[model samples]
Target chain A: MFDDRSPIYQQIANGIKDEVLSGTLKEDEQIMSTNQYAAFYRINPATAAKGFAQLVDEGVLYKKRGIGMFVSPDARGRLRAQRRERFFADVVDPMLTEARMVGVGVDEIVAYLKDGAR
Target chain B: MISLRDLTVRYGDTVAVDGITLDLEPNKIYGLLGRNGSGKTSLLSVLASYRRPCAGTVTIDGVDPFENAALMRATAFVRDSLDVTDQDRIAKVLDFAGRLRPTWDAGYAEHLADVFELDRRRRVSALSRGQRSSLGVVLGLAARAPLTILDEVYLGMDAGARAAFYRELLADYLAHPRTIILSTHLIEEVAGLFEQVIVIDRGRLLLHEDTDTFRARGVAVTGPAAAVEAFAAGRTVLGEQSLGGVRQVTLYGALADHEAEAARTAGLTLAPVGVQDLFVHLTAVGDTARTEALR
Candidate 1:
């Protein structure tokens, strides 16, 4: 289910982040153990552990010592803030660039967006 | 840790494994890769102590493994041509392994046999190719040795059977961590399971590094022929192909961020190359000519 564009660990971290943002994983919810994640994804447990470690480092997830991992209380808000910081450059800028290339004016795009909003 | 210092293996005049030095830390899965006749088996043989190194030395935790009772007993090496008696039933073969290997788990072995749907009453000779491979998986995983070397033990397994084997292997390994070395041609299928990858070519060490690092090494740049050529200039090109006005070149190194941005501005698409493609290009015959032509 993963791709070669990036390391599998990065993908795993991003996948968990996406789940958090989408509310599939609620804040303070207990998540699967690294072993379970590795088994489900058919990946090395070490790789899965690396991904979890990254999330822990980023404050997106927290460990319970002898227990399991839980989503950070502020993880969703923090992730949303991070994605908002890059939304224009990563998503809107490219859309605008493609629109400019195809001779689509900003007014037309605005009109379409307004129509969708209505 | 397992250390090999300038190890070599030879058969008569033919050198199967050239002088190579490597250190394997305990409790990690290593994928051993090589083309046929490239000495992968010989290297594994030396590691498993099935055959002594022609030169150099092999030590496990500061002691030689060859003929060492304790060390050898703690290492399980299962190959395609199993070392079991053809006339023995599957149950008997497993019983023999349990008796010899101190780490063998009979309960786990029985579970694996059920997972593979193997009939324990059937003789080894009567089993199908796929079944034999499954039996090998059972023996290798259930042994749970400190060092387990599976040299193409998946030879005759079908895709489904192989999937089960991979799952079982990973699950068991998680439960009981050990040093696992798998030598196989199925790079893409098994690449994810390897913490580190060791590739050998022509009886010599090609590359050994973290699996993620190795995966990041190969990049495929695709775009207009001239643009692709310009971007590929001064880079190590592993392989390339052209169709009409579009050209794609597989490169042997990761691109710098600025370089990637420049390629994007120039309308070139950079794609990651899979481990299998990288392995094929890296070990392809007559590599110099292909690389030289690009330069």
Candidate 2:
């Protein structure tokens, strides 16, 4: 289900990017048509089209003339690179801040990471 | 596009719709929200040409819709009260619609009947409440009129049937784009489908804007009563309540990211208000007075 905090189109675009990053949607693979996505999610077709349009703008998806949209050839790699750039700020920093608030030391986290690595 | 200028409707001494003006763009889904006796049905009836306004004008495509055959042919309104007669079978009713409705699609109607599990052979009187609502949906969608209005057509449907109807409605809408207006109290259930929303109260227009902006205006902040009150001081407070020592204030305004972050750091929890919650609070009697006073 989509959240109400941000525009639904942005959420749709992010959802597709997540799929690409997870290898569920491969490069050059045709994705569900806007109509199909709208029907499946019970959202307005215009909203879904907006999301797809955003992805197209970002080079994450490409239109096939009269056919439909396909994941761009470098979509996964590009998505991975973008997420990697934000991971520290968006994920790790928050984790570290929460850990600090809970009295979890950096050495404790390092030890836990080392044990999990084995 | 559709426009209503100072439109008003009255029944005996009661004013069902007060003077109001609104313009709706074409091919977009609109959600019409209101409390009971708030003139929602009356307003829609005027738009669909089911009733003539006592004053002002209702126009579709720049011409008066009242008794205008061409415009009437292009508008379809399905009210909670089924328009079909009790003597007619479901198939016979659809057949009648196919003959009268300019854009009626019999094939699609039949497909919808199958999906809704409606018995075409059954008499209108013999069907259950939910089945009748399903039949109403089928007629509305298959008509494919340029302007389609459904006033709480999901009145008796269960959750599953309602979900099915939403899916079919959105699909058909995408396949053939047209204007749609859905009037319902079930805001959260169908808010995602709306492009814009129009809310009315006591026969007067209260709010009309894109759904996102309307939703963003409502937010809830909860924490110590003193902090909650302080943070909500200058904002438009829709509603508020307290439990034990914790208090929550529902506000209607844009809260900047830094402001929200400050609230969080101050040990307050900020949450976005759902469409239903906002609708209820906005239309509630006491809150309406406060809102009007503020305006």
Candidate 3:
């Protein structure tokens, strides 16, 4: 559903981000070439290129010039940093706000995470 | 603003655009995506002032475009058929467009001809499909109309030519920006060109959204069947399939925090949906989020 509403490259960038966060892709790993990614995703090579550029901008991935994009040396760290930066407003804050409405306690959540971890 | 207001177009009894109402802003490229015979052409024709709608109005900047001479002059339609004289040569087409189109650029057209290796003396009807499309491109770019409409402008161009077209399009657009509406089947190739997208399915307005918001509208969640189902609960499911032990459900709507975290906890893949993926699913899908089923 490529539409005229927004540039497709932005979407391609987000797709790569999702792949990274999901661990389907690993840090310091080689990503597919532009042509390979395009054929695999059935996307335009230009769109894929734009996506890689976006990742490079976010420090999630970096280009090694003639080779291809590789998950950055600090890709996981960078992603974790970005996600952590947004955690309060995006996840923790929203979840807390919603939990308060349902009368759930912050202690309960922390305890749950601690237990969930174990 | 460009408006297609409750427009209905027909060819005798075959209804084209059933009734579409859209408000498009100025100075942007719009991608019109849909299946074959899905009324993308008819709707755009009305919008571009080429064909009048049967039941409603299409307006550019405020005036109805039907038979509106001023709008037609300001709007350039560079489709496969733009009513060229049968005997007119390729040079004549350029000359004609140069003379009639409000923003005609003769020098630019000549430059395009040189770039495409097109012979100025070659007649229009005698050209190949690729050449004809290039001619249309040349006309479209040089016309510089405020609103330029192209319906499948490149149907037969080879790979190299298509690449050339893309580069030229981007270069021209950057240098001389204008409102351009493109109707095409090659979604992925041109999706990046659009600033906005309008999807028309069987004459109905499926969606009109910014490229970013549209791309983030859905995601594919894949993993063990039960885990996927648990993670996907209450989401707008676009399409679904599964093996004996695993499933992948394409979900619509923005992915909230809880959902993302839950998916991670459950070990499900959360994939972002692309424009091509959305178009295919919407055109070929029959899902719960659909507004009206096109019969």
* Top candidate by lDDT: 1
Q: What does each candidate score in C-alpha RMSD?
A: 2.2, 2.3, 10.9
Candidate 1 chain B worst ten-residue window by lDDT: B286-295
Candidate ranking under lDDT, highest first, comes to 1, 2, 3
Q: Is candidate 1 or candidate 2 better by TM-score?
A: 1
TM-score of each: 0.95, 0.92, 0.71
| lDDT digits (tens) for residues B137-157 of candidate 2 | 999999999999999899889
Which one wins by TM-score: 1 or 3? 1
Q: In candidate 3, what are the lDDT values of residues B21-96, reduced to their tens digit?
A: 9898887778888888889888877777666678977777788876877777888887776567757888887877
The DockQ scores of all candidates, in the order shown, are 0.74, 0.57, 0.09
Candidate with the larger DockQ of 1 and 3: 1
Candidate 3 lDDT (Cα, 0 to 1): 0.78
Candidate 2: list runs displaced more than 4 Å: A4-6, A63-65, B293-295
